[model samples]
Target: MRDVCVIGLGLIGGSLLRAAAASGRTVWGATVSEVDADAASRGGYDVTTDAEAALQRAASADAIVVIAVPLPAVENLLRQVAQHASHCLLTDVVSVKGPMLDAVRRRAPYTRYVGGHPMAGTSRSGWLAGDTMLFRDAAWVVGVEEETDLTAWAEVTRLVLDVGAHAVPLPADSHDETVARISHLPHLFAAILASVGAQGGPLAMSLAAGSFRDGTRVAGSSPDLVRAMTEGNRDALLPIVDDALGRLGAARGSLASTGGLAATINAGHEGALALEATRDAARSGVRIDLTAADAREGLVALGERGGRITGLDGAVALGEVS
Candidate 1:
């Protein structure tokens, strides 16, 4: 990217700014709060609360504008960006994709918009909680549609690679559905688990072990952020929530039979083992060297052949043939 502008200096945005700066990119940031702007400046980036002015100053067709704010603010920010930086490649780091994609497609019709969600974050919020390694080795989903600009998509893939993330391409609706199952549903369960534990009083809270703490950790995320994500993707999330309830009901019924509970536990163990195997396979993928253009082409060719793209070394990995 020639120039990168990140709007909203929260945890994800701050981390992006830091990573971009470290990579020697001409990075700029914009935030609604003066305090956040100050924080971004302190972190060694040119930042301002005036988003439009910042965009205008950094205006270039090669610039990539990242919308890093909450779902509620995405529409307005996108519209502003569309007006000011129409030629730039636009993307986001929000948790939900469907709503964002719709807003961008409608409001920024003239702009090249790519929907993005980095599958890496903590319960922590704000710039102080940001870390340069937040997206390192993480899965970053980039939403593509018939209207998606190829050059812009390539720019986003490069950004993902630069930030040390594995770029996975998926349609917006598919992205929403998948995240509802893996991300949103987990957050819902975590919040429920945390709430249930709270009702068990001080002794129960004190007795919480590694599993309990680890499972409920995401429940500590900002309530507003959680609420927005859950609500914005309600269409996708509701069915997943219903499926989870059905599974829970089945587990409850299984408690009455002699081997039923054990069967449920065994199923969970099998699932965990399967996940570990997948991770190990990904890590063991064969590395290959090629030029940037050839590497991109190799990734497409490998993906078409049912191979995963694990990582990049300027020359990308074609991954283990499955």
Candidate 2:
């Protein structure tokens, strides 16, 4: 197992550090948050607040570095990376991928990088919320761009699998667009639902049950974190937002003019059914030949069709698709 060095010891990073360590790999981490650093150190993990020092250590030991931080802080961290570990095998847990990929190109141009986003997390955050189990059974998207180093991509994919998540190879742009509709849009919906429900005052709040609580759950997440993710992916998110608004407009028009919501309700029901169908479908096994001429295309196509790499057998990718 390759040594792992994770930067940013919050929920995702701390959890990664723990998971990597548990998987029998040497692991260490750094964080800007003093509280998280102190807590992690007390928890018997090797952690520090010195980002450059940590990067330097990763450089010395040839550890795969995981950049786990907010979008706004990525550039600053990349600056340190440029100075200390510019050629390290790098990956990130940032939710948005396109901007991070672009940032790496502009800031740490020499680092062999792969962008990743684990399709897992909760409204709760911070070091204390770290859980080695958080990523189990999750679909972690690993970028496979034309310029992406296949070796680096494989290393990142292995790390994802080691942490108990299935690696879903994707292009950075495709990841941003796909997540805009699924992740970012849902956060916005949760916020909107919470806001709208709050307008009903105390009586509605008192009467709120499973539906209301579940719908507004993500609205409880930190506003700054939510803003950082959604706004950072604004370009990809805008069209999805427009589509959502259009559907909402149609629903409102139907309610006002015809006193019916069959179109919107039925569409939503079918969409939900499609989700279940996909989940319930039997998956077919596939082996991705990474040594082939069209390896990058194969990886991206597998992700496009919702396949996941369960593990790797040397350079080849062991995967399944529904």
Instruction: Name the best candidate (by lDDT).
Output: 2
lDDT, candidate 2, 1-322, per-residue tens: 7899999988899999999998999999999999999999999999999999999999999999999999999999999999999889999999999999999999999999999999999888999999999999999999998888788889999999999999999998899999999999999999999999999999989999999999999999989889999999999999999999999999999999999999999999999999999999999999988888998988889999989999899999999999
Report, for every candidate in turn, its global Cα lDDT versus the true structure: 0.79, 0.93
Q: Cα RMSD (Å) per model?
A: 3.6, 0.7
After superposition, candidate 1 runs with Cα above 4 Å error: 60-62, 257-259, 282-322
Quote the lDDT for 322 in model 1.
47
Tell me the TM-score of each prediction against the true structure.
0.88, 0.99
lDDT value, candidate 2, whole model: 0.93
Per-residue lDDT over 9-96 for candidate 1, one digit per residue giving the tens place of the 0 to 100 score: 8889989988877777888888897887887777667999999987786575457889999999988987788888877778899988
Q: In model 2, what is the error at residue 28, expressed in angstroms? A: 0.5
